[model samples]
Target: MNRAFHRILIANRGEIAVRLIRAARELGLETIAVHADVDRAALHVLEADRAVSIGPAPAAESYLSIPAVLEAARASGAEAIHPGYGFLSENADFAQGVIDAGLVWIGPPPEAMRLLGDKLGAKALATKLGIPTVPGDDSERDRVDRSAEPKDQEKADAALIRKAKGVGFPLLLKAVAGGGGKGMRRVDRESELPEAIRSARREGHAAFGDSRLLVERFVSPAHHVEIQLFADAHGHVVHLGERECSIQRRHQKIVEESPSPTIDPAVREMMADAAVTLARAAGYRSAGTCEFLLDEQGRFYFLEVNTRLQVEHPVTEMVTGMDLARMQMVEATGKDLSRGQSVVEWRGHAIECRLYAEDPERGFLPSSGPVLMFKAPEGPGVRVDSGIMAGWHVGIHYDPILAKIIVHDHTRERAVARMQRALAETVVLGLTTNLGFLQVVVRHPEFVAGRTPIDFLDRHLRDWKAHESPPGAEVLALAAMAEWERLGMIGSGSGPSVVANGGSGADGDGSSPWRQLGPFRLGERRR
Candidate 1:
């Protein structure tokens, strides 16, 4: 142990919390996991050394509650707290609370988070540092007063429109505190500005409790790439390559891979240098991501800084052979980095597909029910990070992501093939999943040729639907076999299973009637 902390509290749930608990155990440290009522029996809770109930099912009253988390930490005797990615991970006040409670906050300093967490401030800082930022109006030009009267609101809207016009049409109205595409909208024409502004602001307030917004020129036919950054208090920082997150829906990334296929070596170095420059300027430490938009012209612009670990971090880890969660734990002890940029290495290719409990045919609407069956694929070069299990409830109170399947290989082609194989082998019953849709995406000819763009889904799958084609013979046979097994109609042995004399048995010849017949049907009786 580094001695900074012996026991840590994870103030989040799902796969991330389970990830942290495993990392902490590897370092000879104890962990306390907090959960809402709906998550009392969650996989993360079962994995942690200790668990605490924070509040009700609602995130606002539970996972987002600062006091409850701190209280749990104090009660559990945890010397530190790790906010795993979402929830209060990026909340500056929560960081301050952890520090004020006399515990180590396993993340960047609250001050740094406050500065870089705001899109407008980070843009200004990037500009001062000569970093390329998207052309747009900062939040100061379009700040909305939530409590303002109708006239004042109208005045603010008018001013925002004027400033937006200056930036030109085909722009984005984004929340100053936005992340994960929340509180953001695309305005293709001048007429949509007012309604878009109102919706964006309302979403901003509802999602992040911050209605401040900024405008930016929307660059289409672009690829979304982000660089992973890690720093220490001793002023040592390193960039862990880049991730190609262009595969998205509604501006939210669904598929990510490391060693972006489209980035030039020179451009990659430049983007890494820019990310480190901004991190050093902000005095940032811990794990964070610097997002950028790579346009068709090969020019990249700084999008914003995520002040916490990203959902797609596993892709980086698979290529670099590094455990970022463990790094976070060690760095929280005020230690210098274990290695500098020179020692850092990248190998092979890594791809990650986020498995969500949603119906892709129905526009990815969240699906919730008991997970009657859950099976994860495993083998060489395959890794699954999940926080769900059979017989567990999937609620609508949180993100619908059930798990992440990450695959690594010596080449991008192999990686893609491995991911496709893994997805096909994996199974989750009782709720609709995007597994079929993901299969279609990873197998698309353009994706296979590495011609992915930000609008890949829109361009190829605009009217996609599930079950458009019939299952193959193998699939039908497997379903029948599973049903037979479930019904105990087949004996559990290596020999051929048969129904002899109206009793289940194994055939000596290993040639059963069911095996001889391509497809067999069970006799039905009168209802």
Candidate 2:
């Protein structure tokens, strides 16, 4: 049954929420932005046709509260709900709640989300479908038996160790409900298994409220690549090529590019076919991503599936010329795909760099403060999707990502050069950012040669530091003039007098008074 909706409610915040609003407007649909009290004046809220407050600043009481989100949708008279990504996006119960409330859910069906959202379940499905998966124990009985008595605890631990040994060392302990690198740990040997299991369980319980864990053999010197899939209720599914997301830190991707440099036409076809097969078997619809690990032998293993929109989706869109958000909405209405697999075309290479408000020098600690100045690079193939402005205050309550910079060009070399230029022109003056670090990564020789592995950062730039270039002579002169104006010496006769001995005023130290002004960059504070 097809249900048409005139208005849609975005059930997330930040850059993705803003992105949905634009997509909705383009389709002649009214948008309602929901926010926590702290985000009353956020860019998304200001951009939507209507805004509603769900709760306080805490996500639990606001965005994650299904009842509160549903109430906001009802109160705003929204006919459909779009969980952009994260938060309640992959929650199957939330999707059912939306459908139960007589409103459209612009995502996969609840059943499909449940089948593919769980790491264990997805792995089992892949094996059943003859898809290659990393060697590991996907057995639910192997999970830590928390409810067992003290005497049984030792038995449970021993059983888990036996399973780990069978799976082999250098394995990853992952949470069944984990995403974005949360609730995961790596154990290289048998001696570390018990403690690693306990640690992974605690982290998983805290992050996803599920302490269940799964073990998989870790693949080394591998490239993290994912296929973008789109399906409709009419049995149509197509892949939008692959994105190489091997350059990462802490298991979270920071750089992504489409048409992986390592994937030949044959490997690309195999991966695409496997992804489409999984989506079809699971009865998935709407926009989703199927992640994989590609090894040096040209073999690929299926990772978990992200049953929602991805942050790096823009790169796929840039290469395929498709509007994923719009496609999701169209599929939600029971429309068949406008095009088939053979007709889908991919062109020019594209790359995206995620900019975060974190200090790379200080171990990538998150930094929060008011954005003093924000200038995004602009050119023929540059694109920036951002959530904050000059006056916006970044808080510690949410993800530190400020924006994503994407660029496209005819060739990979040209695309790399364009990305470097765009990164250089990007400016965020108020807080410490990874702008310089991103520039360094794109310019590395190995990266240019398309040889990025999972440990690219640790293997290459482990001891990376920010290089501070001294201000130029013109900048010093301007700073001196500004300092003199501030001291009221410009118009007064007591102004600093220049001497032939490289001294100014009464000081013979060869330094100006402005030298006392501690670290500051010359730039106008944008409002």
Candidate 3:
């Protein structure tokens, strides 16, 4: 039975919340935005039709609190809740709670979420369905989960070490219930195994509330590919295409592109088929992603399923011309998909780069402060999905990602060039960012040749530094003058203010000093 809803509540914040709000508005559905105390003035809150304060600054008390989010939904008169990508997006208990509250949950069923959310269970199902998975020791997962006392923990560790020896020296210690690279560690030698297990368990427990761990053979020099999947309640499932996400730091993807540059037609078909098959077997619904690792020999192994919308979904949308957020809402209403696999088409190439408040030179540590200026690039095939504007505060309470820049073109080479141009034109002042580092990665010869592997950063840019020369004395002086004018330290008649392109600082006459200065990297000037 199809159920229609007039309003939906977005249970997350940041760029994804803003994205969902836009998608819902296009469907003529009212949107309610929930936020923490610090996010009262956030972009998503400002854009939403109605806003509710869930709790304080910490995610656990706000976005992750089922009671707070559900109360907000009820108070806002929302008929459905959309958990976009992170927070409680993958939590089965949260999904169940939404259903118990008599509100529509725009995601997979709780049973399916539980089945696929556990890496061990997902792998077991894939193996049963004849889908290839990475070779690892699955025998000791239960022991690790049950071990609590000192003696039992020691035995479990010994058993894990013995099993790991069979898996080989180089393997990954991963949390059974983990995502976003949390609860993951790479062990290259036996001496690093014990501490790695303890560390992974501690981190995993802190992140996902589960301390169980799994060991898998580390596949190096491999490409991280994921298939975008959509399923409905009517037993229909289709895969959009594959996205290559090999460029990562700390196991979290930073750059993604559709129509993987190195994947051949045959392998694409095979992977797509496997992903659809897995989705069907799990009775999955809404937007999900099946991740895999493809080696040089062309052999691929299933990794896990992300049971929610992905951060890099824009690349898939750009290539496939599909609105995934809208599709999820439609599916939640018990509606069948209008298109099938045969009619679905993928055109051209699309690339996405995440803009984060982090310093790449400083081990990618989170950077936070006020956004003084923000100018997204504009041109053909360029799309900027942002959640911050000038005067917005970047805080440490949440993920540091501020925006995503997606570009599309007829070919991968052209898309790469367009991304480079977009990055160059992007302006984010008042904080350290990875914009310059992203520029270097895209321009690297190996990246240009599409030779990116899982360890691309560790192998090529382990000692990366900001090579750009600081702003010249004249540019610095101009910047100082602009700051003084902004702070009202100088009188309005003293001088004209300098502003980036598309900003309002220029006079109404459309002529400004910035126009004559030509191009300069305003963000490159360290604060």
Candidate 4:
């Protein structure tokens, strides 16, 4: 039986949507992209077979609106909805809404998502399955649940404080329904616990619509590793491999690579088994990632499960040679795993660097503006997945990620070098970007040796900045020169092509054939 749909609606924006479009087209399926007003000219919208305007620029009025996305899918006659990564990708209610609308949800079952989406519920399941989880106060888990009460709130606060003290100082207050570091806070002392909890809860509610939080012992100098899992309704599950996402800033990963340089084969197998066990226990289907915090002592604990395609899925695909997005489409339509775990193999090392519209010099604040020039790196062992182009406006209403550059090679060393070379070749002018900072990180000594932990950036490159100066006179002059040559200003002759001053080539009578009535000029004056 063919377990594939004829058309799928990508219910997200940016590069991930572009990724899904290409994959769906390769599988002979029509792709539909839903975008906000600001994304009307986005590359993903242009690439898709069909596009629908969802709502305004703000995500709340657009991408995160379930009704709007469903309406777009209906209008496009899409048979399935693939929530590419962020927005409502891991949203259980959104999954249910899609299913209720009689459209296939191209992700894990809604119930599975609901179960594992709650940090406490997932931790309980992991404990039941004998998977090691971060030690914390599980006894008062129910009492600290999200609820409304001034009197009850005071009691809950005291209980939370007790739990935090027990968990020890330097703990993380993590939102139960959060990912991408949205609702997370790090408290280094007991005095900061109350404020941290209040802020984390507020952000969690605003970001995820769920304010429930959990306190866990912060594992410093730990490696952030996660195993990619694929399961189908036919009771088959397999682990592709693991990605080391330790290079991060503000709890968000900026660089990720496959075949962690830190973990040995023994620990790898153990973690893989643990991931599969948790997946099966939760009745997981479709693509999911089991995250784990690996301590310096080689001990690992279950962190959380991301119930959608990861942002770094390219690294896994590069090394394993698997089309995870296509596999997701097929599985959502009710299919079994293509192969067993025994057949799944990994060949080489792959690294992915996320390029964002931000100024690394100014505290990594998001930058938004028109992309005056755009060029992607091209070569063997290099891939660029982007959703922007020259003249496109990058809006501040969404994730700052502009593109992802992935490189693969026979070894990690070669892969890092390839990425460095690729970054140098790439260009995105007219806006501030973290391109230079990424190049520095990949070439740094600790990164080259794969000695990265969660605090790699903070510990090593706290003052990281672009070595090259911002675009200025030289850059504008070069741009002008390129434009002039393109406009036939230069030729084989030693003299100018048409006129002495490289002007509009006025005739002897000063009647220039190329002169326009307006004041607009075409070429630069000859030096």
Candidate 5:
């Protein structure tokens, strides 16, 4: 066992680093934080016992630089490294390098990372293990550039047409190694296939640096469900139930909930079983996630496996009452997980929404600026896992995520209500954020009732956007403090005022930050 390891280095930044620190502290281990120039003042760095400056602000010069991180770990005397969900978290070479540096790698072995980090490899391995997978394109089709079809082009044209017909129309072009909806396209007609393939290849190259693309059948309204599993080097594996992440935009999940409203007990058990089978086949050790797609008929198909921690690990911790990060560290140290699949008990409903600094109205584009003020929500059932606080600068160098607001309750209905209220109380005024949009989603009748499909937002999102309302007395009151700095007070507080603090400004006419710019303020307050 790694009982001798006294200190660990958290090799990432933001909320995930904070998350790892919390877990490490609880396990009676000191932690180290590595930060880039921009993240030097980040919360994770402040919370860790030791902090090290790795490199410049750009990710390539900082977080993605392996030798720099290892050097920091070695210099800090950290016995092991915990890669929390991004950057080198899934980098197989980095994991092996950590091992080669004589530092404990608090994650799956490098071999297992190879099996799961690559989309094509993971799917092929899953299928060989008899795990039913979605019909994803796993092959790189060498395009016979028709431009190179030669002067005898008529025969080549016939051959091209034959290949197109064989592959069928309405195909999905995807990167052989891609995630987060990158390098993906839905082609609804044959005429769009070649162009779609080219665009997908271009994007794949830009994102993963490899342009290999494949085509698969498009599946609509598919639910994105994943099983969180844990294993030790002893070969004991356990599934920690499934998380419903269907409420997404642009193919990325913004809101995720445990005990999926769509899955029944039988389906949950079956899905969990399938995940365990896949993990066993991989000989995976440590915490990992098995992603899948549920069709209209409720058939589950393996998508790919995330061999490291997930951004939404907190939600699973809420339902399963297990500290996933701590378990990962322990398992990496050769300690067996206490709760096996048979003993893993899920309690209550847990829901999480990612808080991103973005303009939802503008395709969720990333927003960056100084967070002059930042206020996160807090309530009986609400938990906010955030990276930045007031006075922290927000940068576009990394993901736009600000925090993850999660709520836990005994029932799904309560959980929805809790999330709605939590979003309402969340205020981030100085920068644009998805807070207002998140509130609308949380309160939508379809979402509250859990009658949502994959494309629920694609259709109903407009309904929420079209209908703009003036902030009520409460919203004005909450936003009044920040507005007080801009516009003068409305009137005396003897009785009632226009907006909160009697702030003198346009009322329901849409001049308020709450209405005009949406709920995305750089550092708006919510009490």
Candidate 6:
């Protein structure tokens, strides 16, 4: 006779926050949003029934602060707190804090988060369940039982070095605490182990403040595929489907599509089995994503388990027609998941392209500023989940993600066509985004043919340079020089330049003269 939750507090911001709000609203539940000072006018803050200020713009001051989030939940009179995707979403301590505060935590159990949050621990547990994890010489333990001390993050340097000797050289050093490619290092030789270890510890210290790292063999040419699953307190669990997230940068996904084009039905069943087995072994509940590395031979290796809603959950939602957030809320309320997952069955194919505020021409540098013009494509099968508005200012402190453009269709081919059309119609005026590059990728022969490897972007790039400077600075510089010569801005002896036709306007204020996109005043069109 218990309901999971009636009112949920969204303990994060940006697109994911807004995403949870919509999903929860559709289920007829109220939502509360907590924000930092910078996001006072954020879309999520404005959309929620109620809002609370957590802290300043920095994540440490707001989103990641356990007390701040819990306090916001209490003040807003929320019955549960939903940690959407990032920030404190996967923090076991934060989850514990919420439960300790006498509120439901709308995610997998904290025990599950802690156990699988560590790559080494998850791999060991997967192996115990006969689930295939990437092969590594855990020479330290002949059979790595989850009970065995993870040489991946040993208590002593000498022990780690000794274990490394058995695992062989060129092993990966990754943080046992967090994901998103932070605190990771590759040591090719014995001489490199010390530096690699030190480097990893330093990074781990900075990112998670827990310098512990896990050592594993690195795998390449592996496609990243993850299966999203839902579990309720009664122990019923089901897989929504698989997502192809191989297109990435710095180990973070940029594009994700459900019903991976590369996976066969048999392969999907196998992967889903492995994922569910691992989750069941760990007593996992609520929404979570189990990542796998599908090698060239179509063999899958357990990668990690994300213990919260994913940024790409909507892709699954699009295909399955399931409200993942609502499912999570229901599970937290103690409902049988079989009922919910049964009600909403997965259908068609869905693709999601993350529209980041970055430039592809200039090594994908983070682009920021106010969005003078923002238009999301609409149609029968297309959807846009975004946090930015026409007048919203993009800041430098947070992630550069502007929006997520998704397309759903009965077939992958049709979804691709719809997605391509959606991309063409989408526009932003203030800063350079991945708009141009995404169009190119969607049309690229390798992508169109669906023959890309895991390192597709690495091979795609010609010059390997950092993207900290202004986006497309090099391209803009060259174009400006050409304009200077043609318009006679430099001297009379010049050719026709871009500036010749019109003068340049400031881009940060959303008044750029170089761009041609304007607002969509015509009522609205479905993408």
Instruction: Name the candidate that leads on TM-score.
Output: 3
Candidate with top lDDT is 3
Better of 2 and 4 by lDDT: 2
TM-score of each: 0.89, 0.88, 0.92, 0.90, 0.85, 0.82
Per-candidate local distance difference test: 0.85, 0.84, 0.87, 0.84, 0.77, 0.76
lDDT pick, better of 1 and 3: 3
In model 4, what are the clashing residue pairs, if there are any? none
Candidate ranking (lDDT, best to worst): 3, 1, 2, 4, 5, 6
Cα RMSD for candidates in order: 6.3, 8.3, 3.5, 7.9, 7.1, 9.1
Candidate 6 on 1-527: residue-level lDDT in tens? 36457788999888888888998898888989998999998889888999999999888888878888888888888998888887888899989999899998888889999898867678889888888887564332332322212345544556667777777765777777667777877777898887777777777666675666666777777789999988878877777789999998766788888778787789899999888788888999988999998887888888889888888888998887777887787778786655543464678889899999986657677877767546577779988888887558888877788899999999878888888889877866556687767776677767777766677887775443323333344444464444354435656643222221232322333433233322211111223
lDDT of 1 by residue, 1-527 (tens): 24388999999999899899999999999989999998887889888999999999999999999999999998899899999987899999999999898999999999999999999989999999999999999845335454312347777778889999999989999988889998899999999999998889888777788877799999999999999999988889999999999999877889999999999999999999999999999999999999999999899999999999999999999999999999999999988776789988999999999999887767878888766445577789999998887567888999999999999999999999999889876766556778878988999999988989998999999898654444444654565455456447557652111221123322232453233333111111212
lDDT of 2 by residue, 131-207 (tens): 99999986643455433132365665577688889999899989888898877888999999989877777777666
**Candidate 1: how many backbone clashes?**
0
lDDT of 5: 0.77
Model 3 has an lDDT value of: 0.87
Give the number of colliding residue pairs in candidate 3. 0
For model 5, how does the per-residue alpha-carbon lDDT over 97-216 read when each residue is reduced to its tens digit? 999999999999899887787777777777787878756444443433322223444443344334545666655666665677778877778777666666666776655655665556
Which ranges of candidate 5 are over 4 A from the true structure? 1-3, 141-169, 462-527
Model 2: lDDT equals 0.84
Candidate 5: C-alpha RMSD after superposition: 7.1
- Residue-level lDDT of model 3, residues 1-527, one tens digit each, is 78899999999999999999999999999999999999998889988999999999999999999999999998889999999988999999999999999999999999999999999999999999999999997764555453223346777778889999999968998888899999999999999998998888788877788877788999988999999999898888999999999999989999999989888789989999999999999999999999999999999999999999999999999999999999999889999886689878999999999999998988999999877667688889999998887668899989899999999999999999999999887877567788889988999999888888988999999999876555654774576566546545457543221232233453333343433444444346643
Model 5: how far residue 339 lies from native, Å: 2.9
Task: Give me the runs in candidate 1 sitting further than 4 Å from their true place.
Answer: 1-3, 139-151, 468-527
